[model samples]
Target: MQHTVIDGVDVYWAQGPAPMIATLTFGCGVRDESFRTLGVTHLIEHLAMSTLPRLHHEHNAMVDIEVTKFFATGKPAQLVDFIAAVCEALSDLPLSRIEKEAGVLTAEGSSGCHPTAGVLLARRYGIAGPGLAPWDGPGYDRIPAEAVTAHAARFFTRGNAVLTLTGPPPEGLRLPLPEGPRVVHDPVSPLSVDGPRWLAEDVPCVGMSLRGPSVSPVDAMGLQVLSHRLTEVARKEKGLSYGVDGDRASADSASTDRFVWVDAREGQEAEVASILWDTARELATFGPTAEELEHEVAGFREMIEDPRFVDGDLDEFARSVLLGEPYLSPAQWLEALAAVTPEQVAAALTESLRTALIVVPDGVRLELSDVDGKLVELGGCAAPEWQPQGKVFKPSLLARATSAAARGARLYLAPDGVALVDGGTRHFVRFADVVGVLARNGSRTVFGRSGCVVPVDSDLFKGIEPAIAAIDAQVDAGLVFPPSVFAGD
Candidate 1:
């Protein structure tokens, strides 16, 4: 692949066979959005491609944690036209269909499945910045055309984009992109908690996550080998899980997040968690075997050598470039992988364990008392007293409820906010902080801005419906999405 700069945008061109692919990527995604404007990038992406004519080609758009990409694959001429059209569309967005496109985004989000990266990142980084997913998107109803346009102006610019093609450059490829300064993603401030903590969710799977320094080729290869080893032991040898895999996400230029997970049967969650941790501990102690490393490296080399593996089209490279990571060729990457020793993998594993976070199937507890002191909780520091506006409700609970009684708990609802007063501490959630209120299984739960769930267990609190209604009233109608938004359709 050859690299050039056209009108301040980085361009990568490669020669390949028929059915060429052209992609225009911008450094704008979920990480660029604040909590109030969480899904604007996605909304802009959907709108930008809304007018593309689908003839003799296939076109699509994708918005992830850190980038938005529009791509088309077909004849070279069609691909060139698609790229030019998308750039023009971005330059002058058709906001006339804002509501229609938002509805489309809402339907898409409702049917979407949450990835493990979002779930774990929300825990590790909190919900404010790059860790915005795992929580419901900002209500599509609340987003206006002005907000979407403003977001597009900030991110969808020439300087912040890279156009990559896996075919000869098309003649008359006019990329009339918007002009703006290159966007530099600010470093995310991770939550203030020493981790390797444990969290149990309602899903029927067990996942363990670890964070470490920026990804090196060796660390990447080591994680691949370790994931394979765990999968072999957990899924093939013991028949304990249906699938086991590992994935990584970039937290910033300085750090990377690694996740290893296993999907098991309903009754086997604890066992799965135990085996996962045991495997992690063992791997951290001894690293992968030479045979395992060799096998994984071979697989890696094969993927790199695949005909479809266009270096410029790699999501990793796209993200890395935005984060200012040094570029390495496939051969250079292989050499680095070969140089990785078991001791180095072990050391990397050890560093990862220092701040690991284990997410287990809900209602299942894994014995992690040894790491209890390092556990992190969701939400920011306590809100000062002045934030509370008016008292809306104070529900009464049964006397035998020890969890609530012990803390002198009271549900305090206000016009602008809601607070759960436990002893002298107040976990106050403003209406703006609320993502949604869920009423299911005879219980009412309010999800906060940081994805923390404040549950009012039916057995404990009376007069809960009114409290829920009152809280719901304060939230904008458009922002109150359903609970299934989190559950993939």
Candidate 2:
């Protein structure tokens, strides 16, 4: 790959087939926003694109977990105009259009990865970082104009951006982004949990997340071979699943949470989950045959040797450059992949299987034997057995008289945070770790960085005023939002 610097931004390019393309990608994305400001990045992309003049050229923008891209394909002049306009818009975003764009985003709905992918991430890391993928958060319409300005200034600068091209840099190309320091993001951290466990979530398919080293050839091939085997057995033979796919998320600079998700055929969720579990166990215990290993290697070779993959290679390099991640050239990756053996694949799976998290549709249960023939049952995000050491408020007189559930609920308010106790189980979130707090009228729902939600509302208990007041006083003001007045009390 060829590289240079333009106006303080890194520029990378490669020679490829006709119909040249260019991408302006920044390191900031969904993971960078607070829970209250979840859709802020998507909104920024829309705000920038809204500034573009209508043209015949094919151009668009998109935002994902860790990068936002503004891409276009056309003559050199058109490409030049597209990026310049994007930088200008980002530098002076139309604050007046905040309400309009916010509504458009709210109507557009979910952002980032697929819902199943988000759910899998949330299950692993909670409602922060990669886990924030699945939620619309406090609602995009609630994002403040100041927040939007601050976010764009912090991330959409020349120092933090990378420009990639399928051809050499076009003449007169310039990145006019405001000068700012590069933002170094913390590596994503998984919630501290033990062992491989299966649990039910509201997802449509059966999914599994295995924690392992980032971009490891052995782990990648292990997942690839397993995916192919599942497609063969689950789809071709049993007809229990319609699609088998996978996605990956960075857990840290050196580790990743790789996923293998299978969408089931209605009443077949249980069977699909079982097949996924059993096949992974079988492959880990016995490894793949030589024939199976060769087939995947052929696929890798086709990609590595093909000139058309130049653009793909350039994009990967751009991501690595912007995020400061370790980059592996196509040749480097191919060499590593080609050298992988069945034993290495099996060993990788064997180790990652220990920290695997599997999710099935609600009410579906998984019963399986581990590689050692031990019956292992999966668990869900059950609350830890402990009570908040704080002031306790009993149920409201009306709640006690009207409902058993409300009668047994107790609200705890501590200097550090809050919790709700119901049926001897506690749901809690500390103010110090809050990702977001949704406020409506006098009611507030606290969202913890660890994925717990504690509602300090009137319906659950009495004397809720103090709890609500405490929340407002404790959490950062910027991390709290009233979604909408029309959302009701």
Candidate 3:
């Protein structure tokens, strides 16, 4: 893998063949942006893909808690043009334009109340805009546009970019070396303030951000497992969001933070808050089940091994450029997986749930209630607007998107590209860029952390290089970086 500086953006590059797949991940930190603008960055990404026409078909975008992503495919010839357009947008998307496209950031978590389906949802959440990103939407409204633009200028430094390429190599492909100073790491931590605080938003919601003493990777994984399980059990009541889960992260190399959130409809906000408080308190008193504990370890192991898990890394160079973790040979990953245990998960959960910092957002104007969950009448909030975009793609597209995700590609369509049979998968790449001529015998191999495999073979390997280069250029331009880079160290 090679790293370079282009127009002040850190660009990292790697090359390979046909069935090419590329991913551009933007890291703005989880709490870096605000809760109100939770989906703002996502809105920008989606708009760039659907609204912008020059990039053509196959380009796509989305936003996550810690990063935003852009992915594209089709003719490799158009890669550079697409990369330039995306970079231009990143540097200049006006906040006012976004605010108009998305609804007003009336209150913290107000956007969260919007139904999951809509243009507004994409616009309201995730990282984007300015100031140090915060846990809720206050930062979105508080940060000035100039500060946001300046933030963009500083964070999108040359060292922050990494380009990953998969499939065939294009002729005269240039893997540029680091040209300038390394992208300076952010000095201020991306984490929110520790302990509980009352967040009075349009909708009543309760949440707690816990500081776990253990920061070990194994413990981090354990905490995640625990969060998933606890969320599953707690959500048995139909009144709550069934899959309300917690997220565990190691901000620095030695400290961990876990956030658990729960919200209820209008009048039930206090009850929901009490339920969450009790749920957390119970972990220390009742403890996790032995089977649950065992499953946590097994689940974590499977997650680590799941072939379809695209925590980023296509040319395999992304792990080094973005994560900075010692790039372990494939063998080392297996050994590390083997060493994790169930006891560790229980301990992690025990430590995490001992104390609670609860937040209940009652529609009432900044009303603070006691620890016991009880309702306080509040005014109703108006429903927000919703909009949805992106193409209705076939599941097979996934086989081509991930390197560890390829099963096989077949020549059903002849010379240009082949139909990649990716049954039971969730990726979005075409088959022509993923399979190799040598693997044309029609066998199967799973890619990523999920056991997603394709079972057909196509002579698709021939034209994948240009596709890889095209996608590589976008990621290299600093449009995106994966969460795993910020998952731990």
- Among the numbered candidates, top lDDT falls to 2
Model 3 worst lDDT window (10 residues): 443-452
The residue-level lDDT of candidate 2 at 199 comes to 75
User: At residue 76, what lDDT does model 3 achieve?
Assistant: 61
Please write out the lDDT profile of model 2 over residues 374-466, one tens digit for every residue: 444444343334456788988878878888888778888977888887785678777888888888768888888777888888765677888
- Whose TM-score is higher: candidate 2's or candidate 3's? 2
List all candidate RMSDs to the true structure: 5.6, 2.3, 23.7
- Cα lDDT for residue 458, model 2? 74
lDDT string for model 1 (217-293, tens) is: 76786668767777887789889888887765665667767777788877888887778777777887888888877
In the range 1-489, model 3's lDDT, one tens digit per residue, is 455544544445444334355555544433344322234444455334434665454776554433445666645655554555666566566556544343333222332222221111121221222211332332233334554554455444345555444434334333222233333233223212222333344322455555554235454555454456446655664446544645533233234345656545556666666556555545544555566555655765575465433323342345244534235433454455455565555565556543334545534333333344432322111112112222212224545565444444331222222223333322322232221111223322211111112222223244343333333332222222222111221
What is the total number of backbone clashes in candidate 2? Answer: 2
Which candidate number has the best TM-score? 2
TM-score of every model?
Answer: 0.81, 0.94, 0.50
lDDT values of the candidates? 0.70, 0.83, 0.41
Candidate 2: residue 44 Cα off by (Å): 0.7
Pitting candidate 1 against candidate 2, the one with the higher TM-score is 2
